[model samples]
Target: MGEERNRPTIVVVDDAAEVRALVRARLRLSDKLDVVGGAANGAEAVELVRQLRPTLVLLDVSMPVMDGLEALPLILEASPGTRVVMYSGFQEQGLAHRAMALGASAFLEKSMALDDLAEDLLAVLGADAPVAPTSPLETQHPAADDLDRSILREHLERFREVFEDAAIGMATVTLAGQIVRANRTLAALFELSVDDLVGVPFADFTAASATAVRAALADILAGRRRVVKIEHEIAGPAVPLQVRTTLAPVLDSNDRPLYLFLQMEDVTAQRGAEEELRRSEDRFRLLVETVEDYAIFMLSPEGLIESWNAGAQRTKGYTADEIIGQHFRVFYPPELQESQHPEHELVMALRDGHYEEEGWRVRKDGTQFWANVVITTVRNGDGRHVGFAKVTRDVSERRAMLQEREATSAALTAANARLQQVAEDQAHFLAVTAHELRTPVGVLGGTADTLAAHWADLEEDERDELLAGMSSSAGRLRRLLADLLTASRLQSSALQLDLAAVDVGAVVDTSVATAQRTHPGAAIIADTERDLVVQGDGQRLAQIVDNLVSNALAHGVPPVVASARRIGDEIEVAVSDAGPGVQPEMSERLFERFSTGRAAGGTGLGLYIVRQLARAHGGDATYRRPEGSEPGAFVVLLPHSPPNA
Candidate 1:
């Protein structure tokens, strides 16, 4: 218990559970240090330090939530006496310096042997406990000098075994470049026995690089370079092999160079792979440079253009010499450049591995064209981002053609819709015409049959009454037929006007009288200005008045009036009634064929015929409704003029 209390307590912290467990197990090997607790992250380590106040904290550098460097000061703040040693997998000197600057006592790599790691931790804690000796000579020799000799002999034997069994070729060469000793691996490299390789001049085997090798050896002997590495081809028994040789100086206690420690590795396969990669790159570059349809180029990581291919020159109208080394933003339009879209594209490519878009791009001559662009991040063999690969395709003509096709398609669609509407309207016209004809035809047929079958039996008054009814039905049929024929002629553009000096007032008066006879007991009147004259067809003029009066009587309240007046060079003929005028919503299409406002008892063609005939006489018809306490008027304006004058 006394010894345990005297030993320094440690807390192990790492993100990996297994790593923490391994460290705990390794630290147990040291009797001078005690593992008090464990943690998985820097935050937990900080809390553990505050609670335990251990003498030492083995903290991992990289961890989730909080890394060791961030927590180091906080841990020290929590327990000022506690020493933090940074344990990490990275061997970067910057990280080590940063950790030490942040108050870490030591930075130790995780790759160190478990025993070495334990000794390091013990050293950081300033533990005075000596390591237990492993050799049996320590027990046999108690004298200090004899014990030292035994330890030295043990070390020499271990070194000899390690040197003989090393994997790569290893040898010790004198300052004169003579091989003092060579390992089995080195002997096998030369296909000679270890005994025969000793005392041989090391430069004799390096015939291809003998002169360079001698100069490198001289540099090592003169203490110019601490380490020198060179590659040369060796003549092997089967074939020539590429070898990489490293010469590191072994210095004496006086800091002077003693001899060179040589290490060699066969790199024939690596050299072949490098050569093949170079050839493949050459082929790819040639292919890219010859492409004519697309611009392929390279950009440095900073977005500066590095390589421009032949296709790039052709598409962008700039030669390689003129564009290389410029920023890639030169290809973007002013608006996109202002928005930093070019730089944004690189950022997106680096984040998502690639970015693609189609938009306007600018050329060297300041012309703009639609182009499809793709930017891909280029990474080297180490998976480090070194630059970007950009591919651009000019598609201005194709885009223009597509837009034109879209416009044409829209026009055709609209035309087809209008045709379909017309077909539907025609069908409705036929249905309504058939319905309107059936009523009057049935009435006429019934009246004629009544007169024929009961002529002898009926009283005189009844017979006269039936005759009047038959006449009325026949007149209705005649008018309906006339309107239909007129409509058909108007639609076919075959209706011709007979120009004459027609009195608009006289026409209105005659039409009103006719309407009064047809609609007995209805109040109808015609008021017109004197001397209203126009050159037009008289019959068509009368027909227009008849249709308007008929529409008012059929669809309006009583007191229908047909009036004509002269306004400037035109005559305004108006028919109005005292009824809720044409509905505000339905008034626009009232002149359209078959648009009845869904009203019954009419063929739905009266207003349409009135407007068509009015316009045919170099005139137009419109509906006017006053705001309050007034009737709606269908007004027709016709140019008033004399024939040929």
Candidate 2:
């Protein structure tokens, strides 16, 4: 008791309620120092300091009403013997110099560790300041004059303002979980007025977070943790709130557990934003993987493959696993590699920011195909060259289709003897085109008419089937028009790619579902892994897959299997049927426009479109005989992108 009286009484002042509470708790750790009071603003601090005339005052620079700089002189004048230490989170050189010029004993940064803060505080107070009495019985303290009693009363009054006016949820809870003192914010949290919350158990307010809060409190009391910060749902007055809670233990002068100080901050809005951002990323990733008309990939600065997207998998013959970390030169033909064309392309891209060319390139099977290659320089945030973005499209089928159209046009203009046959061919071609366009439209129109005419006579199941048929026909018409427009763009050399990340597996699933809807009788099985992402356009990739599946179902027998799988660095999707396979003689002309077998309904252009779409994505569509059987199989292979690339 005698030593407690002799200890040098100190006052802590900060704008932050938490900082003030922390200072009080920390100061009480040493028997030589006693925290008399705390103030939120400089105005209150000046009054408190004047009345208390303590040994030292820890003053924060930024405060409302009056700042530390403005109140420093007044504090000094009010108590000539008191020492003033200026503290803040800011590390401004001019502020530090000005604080010293204004008679501050020390300028300490608020970011200093607790141990450093204690050492700096003790150093600033000086060794000559009052020390604890050596013995308990020696109660005679000549250092404390009659003026100290007046100071004690002033300190108690200043503390009352801080305890009641803090904006955050603050409370002093007993070790037994009783709330001895709580501010307006804490009471407001539980929907009660401050006056009515005097003896309420802290656990009552902590409905959902009761267990967590009690455990944290116990840890603090047992000295296991210095501070506990956790996010918990608190039962507020009007509604439940997600809050960040902090608990700190207040120790007595003898280093024994005394009370608990809690701070709560509502963070419900922040958590919602985080969840929304995660969902947005998922949507964007889906968009990127659905592409299938262009090969999109990334390379390291040294021209090594870094990322391969779905379009790349479709266009290139490698999967993400097989291609990543390997040099991009793997896609070049032996002649190009020997001539160092790949290196030259990189050099050109680096110099010009981009390089584009159309030439022949080798696929994984060493088969040569015509491709349009575009390489663009990639840079880091600092504008330094990091790598390159490569986009490639296999234009072989498009070139072939255009060439055939031109040849047919030129033949009609010349060869007068064959002009009659040419006109007949033209008429037949137009008829086939009209039939393809009118079939789906007619189905849609007839279904609508039947439903309108027999509204009362049709059963629910029949009506549903008719409505589904109309929808299916409408979708089919839309797809056909899209294919024609794409073909027209290819003929005019106006086809362009809009590349992004796409989920290959999702695109395959959509295509398989569409097939099931269109051909309800066929047993269409889809076997694929989820999250097989690649760089491509979703609509185009779906078109390619749908075309192949439709072709297999129309030309082959039942039990069609559509399977997609990752093969090394590439992705392969195969649609297999159990019907008669492609004749060996027609293998060379199978993908040619106007080259259909004895299929009853096609315009002879479906296979051509499928091949073109696959080629455009830097991939190829192939017709093969199923292993150990005469049945046919249609397959498309695409590339996959690396994770995080």
Candidate 3:
């Protein structure tokens, strides 16, 4: 198709080579319009229009030498029929209609889309399009909205003038997330040219920020989060901007969010102030809470209760509702009621800062809790006293517990004294019994040995009877003496440890031989391992082993087992037998003096003496029922010490 003869010829003028290239390419792509030529400055563009005689001149407002604002008249005078379209940047703030009144056909922003540019050019060249008069108002009339729109447009133009010229950052965005306007303030903030920023999406300026653009959009869309006043930090090509955003909602006539008005103020100083205030409050709260033993409360200026915590209720024994607003005098005992002068204290807190005292205060049930009171005045930013903060504590419970513990300790001391007295008495009785019986039993045991030796000289039957009688009498005397002597030593307060290394095998061997002589007819088995050593007095240790073996033979039916072995660093002397095992009652009292196992007849000092001597030597004695013996086992243990010990 042949190009339409009436299509307007357009000339492009700009200082940037890129601007001339873009406009020329975009305008040339149109079938109806032809891009005549291009220039890098207003002077060149003016000469191009005169030489080419194009239908229209697309003039850039900002250029070197002669600016479009200055070249407009010249371009029109050179070609009077040319429809001049003034191209401006986002930062080109002043209204262009005044220039249009001179000769220009229309105004276009440099950031407009290529397609939009084509459409605008076509619309401008259409027949019957409205021509520019010397003024806008003298040309037409419109309804209320358009009239309001015009007035708002004027306001917007004035705002743009200030934004481009002022030394601050600013922008205008619609609720639908569109960049409706911008100025040099925003261009400098984003480190971009005015034309580069005008039509670009707000998100593009903050493309590196993950949620920065989305967050701003949410503030515009969400009704509840409207007017997001954030001290946002945004990074641009040059530097990071620490900006305080005061976002305001500009509502339409229907009270709907239409325009998001954002005013940015740098508040790095205000941030420092808020942080200090927050830290101070945190420290104060920490101090108050750390008063572990005190009940702190806060009251309003009129003395109305504002808060009560666990301590307040515990110390005063009054719930929040019961005594929150009640007069503090309720806690003061009647005696100190007037002397305390709580009202005067409050007045002092209001005038000065704090009032501190220690006294007795009554609880909810009329009992007195010793209290330490501190009431301080809280103040506001203006330094006017706001209210009183009170701290109180109950020391009564602790005092009572301490007294009870002291009483218990005294009772325990008295009981201990009584036990000592009883022990001394028992000791005296045992000592006397042992001394008295020792002499008589020693004589009897000697006589029995003599009679047994001389049995061969008597008649056969008479020898049997004599031996029987002597053995019975001697056994009784020996048991009685042993019991008394052991009991006496058991009650004594003082004891001595003669921890010396002694050969355990030698002791067991000697004890078994002694039992053999003591009970000739009894079957007593003895076995001692070699080199089994222990720490104890040799004499007392021998006595301990002898007692265990004799106990086994007397109580055991027939077979008595005696063995010695090494266990860890100690020596174990075990005596077991196949006899009536120790009963439950016998097992408990079996070691008690004068309480022999049931069915056994003895003074019962043997086990008692053995256990005491074992403990004295830093060892122990134990009885266990052997598996096959049908009787319990008895083990006498002694610890082995160093050879030098």
Candidate 4:
């Protein structure tokens, strides 16, 4: 009777067998509550409570045969001191009040947690009721007697069942960090059974969170904190689990730390959701902050600036703080703002979801730039417009490049027009040259016929005169044709030279003799240095001297002087005539093709050929007045070394 009185005797009434079993199982969590009997209905509950005379009757409101509201008064009448706790799946305040009026001590919903129901029952039993003694492992205090030992065993069994059947992972770890007891939930977390988890170190399963878990345990053992809760990973065998762990020190009566009570909740899904949200924000921030080519930003629905990114700062030359909250029309040019273009863009974007345009825009420093702008409507999940996402790009450099290309194309067109005029001029010069060839040819033909037909019938002097006339005409014709051939070769770039060592003074004498024979009226004199050797094509050098002498005889007063001398490393050959020098205006262009002066019988190609051949032999040709303003002198200078050198 003493032991039975020490525990609170209770009767459980439920219609379902599973409900009675669950109530019995949960009742085992408290050793102080002893289930005396069970009834399937309220009428049976009243009989059971009266027969046992238990301290409490947990009656379900709904039952077959008789309901709890009808049996409540009978149960209380049979055992006047019994506390009747009415519980149901659904809560009705009116019914609960009626049950209370019928002598029910407490009303509770069946959906309420079993642990809360236990607490409510304990509260109704009061502090004077017998409290279960601490388990033998929990304290060093020995049991006073058999009753105390009996209470200790009951309490230990109750705690053991509660720990082993918990929904979440639970373990009791000694101060040495060894797990002395672990529930099925904790063992299942590591893919092991409860027996296999005991005696294992709890730190082994939390390799990654070892330091944090250890520090938390230390704080609890030191009595600095009652509980430490943290989220960490448990390295299970199959896959790691994200767990929210709570570590609390179970204390003895003297406040000494006994053991650690650990609760681990698998939070992998919860943490994964949080991580996904974090990465999504990070990706959005990275995309907006890293773009440099386009100015990406946001504006309020009313076209006021709202947000700015790195691209907007770099492209618009305005910092985020300076630009945000300002009207977006500040980016438009003065005329565009006056015409309400910014407002128009927003309206179009709102209507069509987007707007794009290219036009002039103003920068922060008041300079204008060409920009490609896009305004995209930003909407909420409900499809209501919230703002505009504006993107702008400066196209000033591209526009300038296109303008420069147009200018270059126009310049090329004008240059082509000038080339066409030059081509026409060349065609007309060829025609005039062809007409000049007939006179010399006709004279030579008539002179040759006269000399041949009347050789014997004519007098000696007459025959000689005809013969001389024929010879002069032939020389005239030869000079005209040679000039034409040389000009042709220069144009074609096919004139070939065979170079050798030669005495340039001898070349000068031969060229002078030929010039004198061709122009009998012009007295030609040779002034040359002896043994003045130079490297050149012998035949080409003679041609050079001959052309200079012929030019002097044709254009200047006699006598024409052909002279050669070695000056420094070069050989200078000068042919001078006593005549007015070249005109100042024509001097610069004297060596150009078709350039000429007074005499016009021969083709105007002599001076041009002279200059080209001289340059090919690594020398130059020039016409200038001698010192003291004497007659014109045509000079040719050749290197003393061989042409190869």
Best by TM-score: 1
**Per-residue lDDT for 1-645 in model 2, tens only?**
443356667889887776677667556643557788899888998899889999989998878899999989999999989999998765545567778899999998765544345556778877654443344322465443233333434444555677678887887778777788888887777778876767877766677888887888778778898688978776655777777878776654355666777777767788888889889968866665666888887899899988777987877778889899999888889899999999999999999999999989888888888999999999977999999989899999998998899999898677765676557646766787788778778988899899999989999999998898888888878777777787677657687767788888888888889788777777998888976777777877887788778887877777888888899888888888877677777777778665673345576667777778778788888877656654567778877776565
Q: If scored against the real structure, what TM-score would every candidate get?
A: 0.69, 0.35, 0.34, 0.38
Best by lDDT: 1
TM-score-wise, the better of 2 and 4 is 4
**Model 3: per-residue lDDT, tens digit, 540-630?**
7877887888778777766787889888888788888887677776777777655563246554578888888888877888888656624
Give per-candidate clash totals.
0, 35, 2, 0
Q: What is the model-wide C-alpha lDDT for candidate 1?
A: 0.85
Candidate 2's C-alpha runs over 4 A off are 1-168, 236-238, 251-257, 294-309, 324-645
lDDT of each: 0.85, 0.78, 0.70, 0.79
Off by over 4 Å in 3: 1-479, 493-500, 585-589, 592-601, 627-631, 641-645
| Ordered list by lDDT, greatest first | 1, 4, 2, 3
* Winner of 1 and 4 under TM-score: 1
What is candidate 4's lDDT per residue for 1-645, written digit by digit as tens? 444446778899977666676676557544668887999998888778778999888888767899888898899899999999887764335456667788888887665655455668877767444445544432553333343334334433543576679999998799878899888888888888889888988888886888888888888778788889988787766787888988877655366777787898999999899899899989988998789888999899998888888888888899999999999999888898999999999999999999999999888988888999999999988988899999999999998998899889888887887576557536645654665656656767776777678667889998777777767767767777777777778788988878778889999998888777766776899999877777678887887888888788777788888999989988999999887777777788678766563235445577888889899889999987656866679999988864345
- Looking at candidate 1, the ten consecutive residues that score lowest on lDDT are 147-156
Q: How many Å off is the CA of 33 in candidate 3?
A: 99
